[model samples]
Target: MKNEIKGCIKALGKLIFSLDDVLNEAVEFPKEHFQPCANLKTNLKLFAAALQKIDGKYMARKDECRRLMAQEEVALAKCLCHFRAGNFSMDLLQKAVTLAAVYGTRRQAKEMKREAQKIAFQYDLRSQNKNLVTDSKAKWEIMEQLMADIAHNINPADYQPEEQIAWEQILDSFEEKLREKNLDLKGMDYNSEIEELFTSAREAVVPLKLAEKLKEVAVERTKKQKTLLETLERGRE
Candidate 1:
């Protein structure tokens, strides 16, 4: 765990230093040469590492990624690196506000990064204690996970968001039904129809384990709901 933490921290610091350099030297920097989005996400997986034993168990975590100065949330983030904030362009500021709704404001991102650093520092201090075991099972497990993630880093962006895919599938299903029944599309509510499909999705597109878990949940929920109703009826009496 400690070893993995060290790798993560190193990665994060490298990412931060690169971003800060860009932010501080916006004029002198070459926009085409630097890749802020890729750098921020990739290097965030690295930072300084530390460890501690809490309640007789070792705990290890990476310092959260800090991309405040350079990493903008996608388009918004790109805009800052591309244009000068000192220019006071209303268009840029409006774009910033729009993107901030989803990605959070730059000020907020800065604070989050700062807070993460503080937490990381705490861990660093804990790691300084010589009592931690260097040869532990947890340490190796973390190292393995880190290596695997690096080797096969398939992020969600590799495909469309699940919600979007489901919506398209539902739309197709609805279209098929409309054509079969010779019905007008005018009174159909896609949102409600989607909800209905989800509610009755006993055969929803999911892996076997997830489907089984849902079944278990349904049975557990029904049992609890039944018990609550019986208790309520008794109280009324």
Candidate 2:
């Protein structure tokens, strides 16, 4: 189970990296228009449903996963501003909290909580920059902080000293590369990892009952998203 969790985290990290890369390529595309509203929302709902499925199965640390999923929805709400960019900036903050609480020791969890607070501040900064912040601290500040934040993640406090050192080095290297490319680590909290977690949980095929529950949740979220989009359009009109 431990190894499985590690693999899942790493795979999720890679997926987050890929998503950030896509956002970074926004040289010409509108920041929030990389994907159509309907498609972006559908994918997000699917991912959230997958997270819900895994949270139901994993019992342990399931609360953390649930909390993260809630935060993800909050992040997605920014997509209503389709003309703006970077609605996913708080993703790592959510993921870091979950990862620390679930897999780290007491000290690491504390560190992650601190990280979360800083990220929340960044979210405020980003918001203010949209309409309020002066030229001093703009959106780029948030991006720069995030690009640095990933490196400072506390290793699971239980790791051996050597392991912790190596992990820190890895994070440093990863962040450096992202900086070199001027990419914002905006999508670090992807829930798509839950799909793999669900598969791993069922060595046998997904249980019929669990599958049905997830399907229902997805349908409900999709409906909610449609309603939200309609409301936004109405407000525009």
The Cα local distance difference test for each model comes to 0.33, 0.36
Model 1 weakest lDDT span, ten residues long: 47-56
Candidate 1: regions farther than 4 A off: 20-171, 174-193, 198-237
lDDT of 1 by residue, 1-237 (tens): 444445445544454456553343222222322232222222213210100001011112223222211123333433333222111233444555554433443454464345334534544423445322222232222223232222222111122122211322333454455466575433233344433443343234344565466457547645854654454345435
Q: How many clashes in each candidate?
A: 14, 0
Structural similarity to truth (TM-score) of each candidate = 0.24, 0.21
In angstroms, the error of model 2 at 91 is 9.2
Q: Highest TM-score: which candidate?
A: 1
